[model samples]
Target: MAELMEQSLLAMREGAQATRDTGAACDRIGSAFDDMRSAAERLVDTAAEISTFVAAIDALAQQTNLLALNATIEAARAGEAGRGFSVVATEVKALSTQTRKVTDDIRQHISGLQAHVTALVETANGVGARLDDSRNATERANRHIQDVEGAVERNTASMDMIAGLIAGQKDATVKLEEGIASTLTHVSASEIFANEVVGAVSATDSVVKAQFASLEAFEIKNYVLHRAKSDHTLWKKRLAGMMAGLEGLRVDELVDHHSCRLGKWYDHVADPVLRNHPDFRALVKPHEEVHVRGREAAKRYADGDLVAARAAFEAMNVASTEVLMRLDRLIAAFQ
Candidate 1:
């Protein structure tokens, strides 16, 4: 009886040691998961920085492309002296295209890396859940041993289950290590591509600058037109500023800025030129008339004729419906 008891005690001690080993393995796996999560966060931050830099580069490239196009057109117009500038412009335009391609590549790769990291995070969560189950199983086995002094059949079966759990965990930990390592390798490649894009952007400056510096005032106007393409957001903002002044019947700030902008639109942009259709001309006439009236209203506000200014604003609102109707036709055609 004494010898049997010693053997039983020995088995329990061995079981305890195995449980400790399993717990230690879980701890190490948890640490590795934390490290991987940290690395993925760093990659996210780096990708964001790259995105910001790429936006700046995109704006620079667009300006360069536009300026180059104007240079090419004027070279055609120049008929002779422009031949050299035309060649230079073509080269700069090609560089801008190349820069766009590189930025696109970087964006695509970084997006893929983000998806990859998300998967890694999901896997980490799964590992954590599995670890929780493992800890519970270990604890249950310890409690069973304490509750009973010795019972060969039941305790042995429980020991077998714990042993299997530990073995399974070893395999899971190996897989987690491999997965994290693979994701890291992909992130490294994306980082390298991002760096390459940065280098290409740096190379574009000299050519872009040289091409832009060569343009005269007239050619610069072409760039201005390219940039001023119909943007209702800017139009709305300017109109709102003007209305803010007009609404309060305060024309002091309006004369210099918002009023001047409207006047310029009337003076240059909305100049009644030959239209493709007589109907088109008729359609736009109301807006032109209303704009003229709005400016007159602004002047009345400046002269302290508040009633006349408010009535003119009311008329302008009615005419804006005509303008929007014309816009709706254009929008339908474009779509």
Candidate 2:
């Protein structure tokens, strides 16, 4: 009887050991299931993140489309002057369309990934239901979640690069606007200068007409007699002074000095007609008494003569109307 009792006790020990082993197996299966549940949750989060990224991409694409449309409208309003801009606008529109297409494609890819993830999660759940544990499945689900996160990070980086490119384009557009403004300003200045030139020419014409009228009314014989006598007296004094200064000077030196003085006189006479007048023309000729008188005067320190040079220079500084009249006559004859 004692032998039978010992054998029953041994059998009871074996059965307890088997029960403990089954309990340990169930615990491992439960841990695996817990891990799978956590992985599924992580995958869902990743899908959510991707969805948000896709939505942001969509918003950006829409903004790009709007900007392209605005550019096109502006180009159209600019007419023929904006032909270059219009071409740029068309290129921008095409780029926007391409961006939209890429965004749509990304959206579709994300949606498909989400769908696949959902199906995977459902399959894992089914496997968990049929299996005693889900530890291995949970680990696989977690790996998928990590892959999805990596994809999201890449997409975000791509979007950032695109945003930076757009900002650069905006800067270029601003510079183009500034260039157009400068061109308009230059065109305006040219028009103003042209108008001023026209007004100046008109005033000159009027002055010349007035001067001609004045000359017509003068008594020619009386004027000639008076001018000739006054010229002779002035020339005699000038010649005497010049000869005295030339006591030690050579003929060539005198001639050079005289030529320079004549050039200065020519510059002093701003009015071409006055300088070329018949009376003044005859006086400045080489070998003439008047020319010799001027050369002689240059050798003397005469206050009166210095005063005359200053007066001549001052006379040239007249109103624009008078100067323009002389310039007009010169231009007309040349033409």
- Candidate No. with top lDDT: 1
* Model 2 superposed RMSD (Cα): 42.7
Global lDDT scores for all candidate models = 0.64, 0.56
Clashes of each: 0, 6
Whole-model lDDT for model 1 versus the true structure? Answer: 0.64
* Model 2 Cα lDDT, one tens digit per residue, 169-239: 99898999999999999999987886576557546655754664576577553332233333333333333
lDDT, candidate 1, at 141: 73
- Candidate 1 Cα misplacement greater than 4 A, ranges: 149-335
Q: What's the C-alpha lDDT at position 67 in model 1? A: 93
Error of 1 at 61 (Å): 1.9
Runs of candidate 2 exceeding 4 Å displacement? 1-12, 127-335
